[model samples]
Target: MLHTNARPSDRHRPRGARGFGLAESLVALSLLALLLASGLRGGTALRDRWATAGARDALVALVHEARSRAVERGGAVVVLDASTHVARLESGGDSVRQLRLASEFGVQLDLGARDEVRLVFDAAGVGRMASRSLHLTRGASSARLVVSTYGRVR
Candidate 1:
């Protein structure tokens, strides 16, 4: 007898429910925040991977350039300045290329028990330092670059 003006569907009100309440909204919001946090973590991991890979690739390319320059110019030298974190390419007593490892790629280079490591390539593209191991690191990723005596990279 107390029937108000309510829609037919609203009259039934399945399970006697009105609509979403504050509790339901809070639950949905919490779920969304959890998913967002997980996604951000994945993105951070991906960024670290890219940074590490970029540093490693730059070192490899530097080595290749030094080798080719030696063959073309009869001799080339790469000086790794641990203090400055720079890789300098010298040809004819001039700095042909300089790579700022830390500033450019946010990578750290470890030179074992030395402040400098010099790599010289002869006219025949032969490397003087053999079995020299270099470590490139960024964030949680790391890679080892080794130059063999036979001008081969391992």
Candidate 2:
């Protein structure tokens, strides 16, 4: 039985929720697009940051490798910054090189001095009679790879 004041049409109202109107649908679509755009932009930025950091870490690791190789081979291993994106290791100033690597991440290397030839790590894992400064850079960020006067790497 229906209430005395209830309209007959109201009795026939369908159960459950109603569907969205055109205006509501449009507003929802707009909100979704905005969210998607923000997410994609953030993702791209994070990827670039990761790539840059990865490149920096890899270069540091290469320095360690060069030193270790020099000690293992009982000779001077020269680490050269062939370019902003390339590096190589030459043993005993010979044309024959042991290892070479190119940047796979979003970073670059800039030598502090043009006159600087190459990093020579002796058989004891110590830099040659000199210290060198290798600059690790990315776009606007930079880190100094300093070799101490005592042939210590820092």
Candidate 3:
């Protein structure tokens, strides 16, 4: 008979069974936190960019809708009221449509020298105003909707 100095429990245990130590777990947790922080910052920036794009598209759509309504109704005027942060359509002294801008989008409109900017469209779907630029800004991003003298939106 051979004699060995091993306990009965040790004899039944797997040789290479190991688990993560406290220090290793702490390091992993720290790395995870760092990654989460970076991801959160990136997400915030992406959200802002998305909001800016949405606001710009909304502005373009408003202009196009106003022009279409003018053509359909024989003539129309689109009013961008800064005080209300809304775009309103009027045709033949009757209200057509109103689009309210979301405050979270941070859209700033530069309509030159008017508190309420008006873009007039004739029955021919041509802009009746002189060549003008409408600036739309959100945070650091900006887009310009140019209304040419020929009544074209570029």
Best by TM-score: 1
Per-residue lDDT, model 3, residue 59, is: 68
The C-alpha stretches of model 3 lying farther than 4 A from their native spots are: 1-25
Predicted candidate 2 versus true structure: per-residue lDDT over 106-149, tens digit per residue = 55666655623566677888776566676655545555666665
lDDT of each: 0.83, 0.63, 0.76
1 or 2, greater by lDDT: 1
Q: What is the descending lDDT order?
A: 1, 3, 2
Ranking of models by TM-score? 1, 3, 2
| TM-score per model over all chains | 0.75, 0.62, 0.71
**TM-score of candidate 2 on Cα atoms, chains taken together:** 0.62
lDDT of 3: 0.76
Candidate with the larger TM-score of 1 and 2: 1
C-alpha RMSD in Å of predicted model 3 compared with the true structure:
4.3
Error at 58, model 3, angstroms: 1.4
Report RMSD for candidate 2. 6.0
Task: Tell me the spans in candidate 2 whose CA falls farther than 4 Å from its real position.
Answer: 1-25, 36-48, 82-84, 92-103
Listed per model in order, the count of residue pairs whose N, CA or C atoms clash below 3 Å is 0, 0, 1
